[model samples]
Target: MTNTILGNISFENLAREKAEYPRLHMLKPESFKHIEIKNFEKVEKEISFEIGYHRGRKRWCLDIYTHRGIRCDGEIKFFSSIPAIREFIRKEYQREPILPAFNQKSATSNFNI
Candidate 1:
C-alpha cells in the first residue's frame, strides 16, 4: 500500500487532504488524511477513517472502511459542521491515534499524540 505522513504518523494508501478542524487544532488537516485502525470481525482486522468535506454533497463526512468491529463497521457518516466533526474525532480518538512508522520517519514530531 502507499504511505502518507500525518503529523508524525504514517498512514498507508491515504493522502492528506486540504481542510481544517479548528477544534482539533493539534491535528493539522494537511498532515493526516485517514485514521488507521484495527478491529475484530471474525478475527482481527484493519481499517481507516477518511474525514473531510464532500464537495458534491457540500457537507462534512467521515468514511470508515476495510473492517467490521465494535468501533468501526465500515460506514460513512455525515456531519453538518466542523464542531460535529471535531466531536466525532475526539470521540473516536479518545487518546490520539498513533501507529508504528511505516518506512521512514515523519518530517515533524511536534504532534502531542
Candidate 2:
C-alpha cells in the first residue's frame, strides 16, 4: 500500500481541503504529505475506535472505525463534528483527542484522530 495516503484518504490534501481534525494538528506540515497508518489497533481485543475525517459536498465530519470483536467485522461510522470525535476519544482511549503528541510514536499515524 502507498504511504502518503491511507486507504483513499490523504492528510495533506485534507489539510489543504480544510478537513484536518484536531488530532492531526500534531503532525508537521511535511508529515501530512507522507502520512500512513495501520488499519487497526490491537489492545486486548477490546473495542477500538480509529478516527478518520471526510468532507462531503454538504458536510465535513469525522469517521470512526469501531470494532468489538473481529477486526474485519469493524464498521466505519461518521460523525457530524469534531466534538464528537473528541468525546469518543476521551471515552474510549482515556485521553483527549487534541492532546499535542497524540501519535508521535506510532508507525502508522495517518489514521490517528
**lDDT against the true structure, each candidate:** 0.46, 0.39
lDDT of 2: 0.39
Candidate 2 lDDT over 1-113, as tens digits, reads 22243332333433444533322221321111112235774344334334444534222344333343455344555665445666765675565443233333242343333
Cα RMSD for candidates in order: 11.6, 12.4
Which lDDT tens digits does candidate 1 get at residues 5-73?
445333332235532221121233222333444463234445466565555666666666654345545
Model 1: runs farther than 4 Å from truth? Answer: 1-45, 66-73, 97-113
Colliding pairs, model 1: 2-13
Off by over 4 Å in 2: 1-10, 14-44, 57-71, 92-113
TM-score of candidate 1 to 2 decimals: 0.36
Query: For candidate 2, which ten residues in a row score worst on lDDT?
Result: 26-35
lDDT of 1 at 52: 50
Which residue pairs clash within candidate 2?
A: 37-108
Clashes (candidate 1): 1
TM-score of each: 0.36, 0.33
